[model samples]
Target: MSDPSEMSNVRILGDFRGDPSPSTLRLALAQVLPSDAESRPSAPDQSTAGKEDDSDGAELAMQKLRLYAQTAASQGADVICFPEYFLTGAMHSSWKAVRERQEPVAAHPNPEEDESHWLAQVAAIARESDIDIVAGTVVELGAHHIPHRKDAQHKTGGPGSASKESSDSAVASKTGLRLRTKDSSDLLFNTAYYITRKGEIAAKYTKRNLWHPERSVLSPGHPSSHPSPRLFNIETRRGLRLKASMLICWDLAMPEAFRELLQPSDSRDGPLDGPDVVFVPTCWYATDAGVKGLRWNRAGEAAVLDSLSMARALETESIIAMCNIAGPNWPNGGDAHSFQINDNTKDEDLPIVGVGHSSVHAPFLGCVGKVEDGNEALLLAEIDTKLLADARDTYRVRYDLADAV
Candidate 1:
């Protein structure tokens, strides 16, 4: 279990926060299967009674999750992956519902207050469990922020970015700005972050393809003007470079986005230019009940992305993991309402269930070991470092056109 952590010069995490925690999260790399315990694929919570409660409810949930995280950690898992917003369901739900509205959703206690505690908890979990973690994103920026615009870079804003004196949130410090996903008018970057097991920020990325109203809340991706802007290059703890990236919930529906991640023509110049793997961490809520799992909506986009990503992973010898939210939407309603700004879904029964098939794809794109079923889980698969080395050496993959003869 600790072998990976100890051997890991750097660890990359892909958190799938199913709902919201508002507390601490202890994720495990992978849990060893017990002979006696039947492998019951985890799914969403059927009961929605606890939807209204906060604080204590959050604590109770954490206690249950602690047991789950401990199971994986004690088993020897090193890097634990979880869903997005793994801390607070209440905030996430309210935010999703109220985000597009004139009124911004506010967490009772404090917005920034949520993630710090969770971050501290994760750090403590790592120290105690001897494991590294990827805790999901939290809605902590209701206050103290700016835009990417030069004038707004250092400018301060009140609460949300609503003032004429407010700054743009696009210009990031050293990591650079997020890719604008929506039209030029919209400006919210669907941000994704990479954290080292040591709890340091390795890299940060944002969703390039906005899903609709989600587009309204996001700006276009960083490389939107370029040939493609849809991948995050991660430095794995194994010293083996992993180009694990994300394309939020709706981005999965964009063919161009996933296609760009697999192909290296723009950056390098051709196929096999490294970045064999792509990661999509999402808030995917399913509408159809018959579907085995929740997939990115927009026709069969999720499956399409899966097929395309798998094909590219095999073609380029990379990996693609889609870590999505698990568990049903507390009350199990919504799908009929549009994101207000103007985006609407064709289907209305979309379940808020954040089910995940957190599995690893081999060089040939075949799945390795098992996959994660429920919302809150850390599914680990051995991403062969040697294989990546062989591919990189066998073919110059960093940048196709850049390294092209």
Candidate 2:
């Protein structure tokens, strides 16, 4: 059993002028991946392969998510977040395979229409568990028809150039666009959905920054002509409102995305308090030998992930909950050490990865609660709304930025 004293403290904020007591939100990070063995159909089912296999994989993934969510809820987690692409597993080895497995967003801008959809099932679990859920990223087929590469390799050169094949033929052949005029379309996006405690869809954020290989199959959320807001506002059951922002895996590597969410807006109507929490769902890969030298002798990928999360949290003065996928089947599988950053701590002070470390960070306190790597587990932490507010009040980073702007 865990000791009660080790649990993070939740302080109440605001004056006691008949205001409701401060609510402590128990946030849970689910760091587990879908089992590849379970996803595979039995030997008897191999006769009808392809589509059946994809559907089976989707179903299995959802089951895993629901089970974990129930566990978190039972442990009294108010909000739970899974890793990026937890719904569909990692990217496949082929673009064609990816396109074939992509699921269409039910009735665009109106996901509630289909109650039996995978995403709806996710919401149902949240509602049943009485917890808000950041259900991770799913491959959403959009309404546009864009040309994509036939192979899954990342492009090394400029646009229209292929690293493994001839430029002219590869570009011309792969760029062939089969126009789709139907209202329901076939464009693909890496999308994450936020489900309220009531099991209602709150917001959906598409990946704006695509990793090199992902560019071959997925489209960016904000194209040149169309724009959308990545940040969202979430209100807890006790009326503790938090300005929340979502960022997919590779998006964290780009500082601009965080800046946009953290920086005060030009309009007077913009949030005066700025974002309180940033949720990052990632499937970051392990660094290769070449990159290890630049990152020092520490755990390459894990170090980078921890550093980025901490840096972002300190710079923005907000709590960061970063959940990552873990399993032996993953590429560089054990390297997926998820971390939360609230401040700087000695590298040696952190625990080494047994499976992968998942944690929650509080403003100025580095790690408030954490689960070391190895087994699948739920990391729960109590985030005090008042403490967060007090930190912002003292730092005044948001106020200073607003004034400077």
Candidate 3:
């Protein structure tokens, strides 16, 4: 119930911004559930098709999230974050399939009429649990000007299709639909929402960086012509004020995205400092061939993901909480019991599913706490705001790099 705006009393001392009052925040990261089939309710009608299945999947996901939120709150977590696309599993299928599964954004005219009431339920859960919640990323459809590709029609045949003559026919046959160039009209975005303990939406961050496959479907938040980065200032119930920002999975790979949030902009009135903590809701995956070209024989891709998390925390001099999916690839058929939390299995013997290594990294201490590899569980870490203040004084990275291009 604390007013976030009233808590913004950061003082400007010489060249640096300082906060005299500092407090610790207990953070929790919830990995994706093992399987929906276990908790999913029986279908109303066996003949129900695509759209009905989508609805059922969304409902099941929400049910699991509610359970996680309740558990995190019971464990004394001040704020809990879910993995990216936790609601609809947007990246599990093709773009067209995602569009069918995604719920419509609440309209200003008559918000109650929207097909999915998932947002409202999320807010209610936050309020009931008395915990701040980052409700992962959602696929948002908005109108934007997208230029048409010159050979879009020809390229639609297939990845290796050379002949342009049968391009249209091949595309229709492969997808069971006609291929058409997208006009300068509507586009989709991967957007994350920050809900306060008061059950209100504090901020919304649209993903700026799109992964390779995502580029073909989703639009960038900061396109070439327009640039708008979002940040949030949250005041915890315990009277702790922290500057916070959000970055999707791929956004963590781009340093410039973090730089944009840390630096003060011309539009701001006073000197701006970097975020105290960065919440990353990711679905990062590593294959058998390893990430990029190099493979670290023993650690494999999970090590690569951890290295990125550590490097980002060290470079930014801030706390980083990375929440990732913890099960086998949903689209690809694989072991159903991979991410299950079994009491009989030893820690080392757990199945390595989706290379899950959800962790929390501190500016000074590299890895504060992390979930064991291949385990599906909540990773909690206590982040001291005073440590961040102390780290800035020792490193002076922000102050030294403030004027650098």
Where is model 1 more than 4 Å wrong at Cα? 1-53, 56-69, 90-92, 96-116, 142-190, 216-247, 253-278, 288-302, 312-317, 328-346, 349-355, 369-378, 391-405
lDDT of 2 at 294: 21
- Tens digit of per-residue lDDT, candidate 2, span 1-405: 112332222111111223235566567787766433343332212322333345666677677677767766656666889887677656442223545655555444555556767777887887887789999887766664333343233234777656544543354345322222345355667788889889888777878777765655566665331244546778876777787888887777787787777655667743344567888887653332122332454356666677777777766778888877664422334233333322453332232232344566667778766555534556677767677777777776677767766
lDDT of each: 0.42, 0.61, 0.63
C-alpha RMSD by candidate, in order: 12.6, 9.8, 10.4
> Which candidate tops lDDT?
3
| Model 3 stretches with alpha carbons more than 4 Å out | 1-22, 34-52, 90-95, 101-116, 145-186, 223-229, 265-272, 288-298, 329-353
Global local distance difference test of model 1: 0.42
lDDT of 1 by residue, 271-318 (tens): 434354555555544333323222333234235434554554554455
Tell me which of candidates 1 and 3 scores higher on lDDT.
3
What's model 3's TM-score?
0.71
Count backbone clashes in candidate 3.
0
The candidate with the higher lDDT, 2 or 3, is 3
Model 2 Cα displacement at 93 (Å)?
4.3
Q: Tell how far residue 79 is off in model 2, in angstroms.
A: 0.5
Clash pairs detected, candidate 3? none
lDDT of 1 at 373: 41
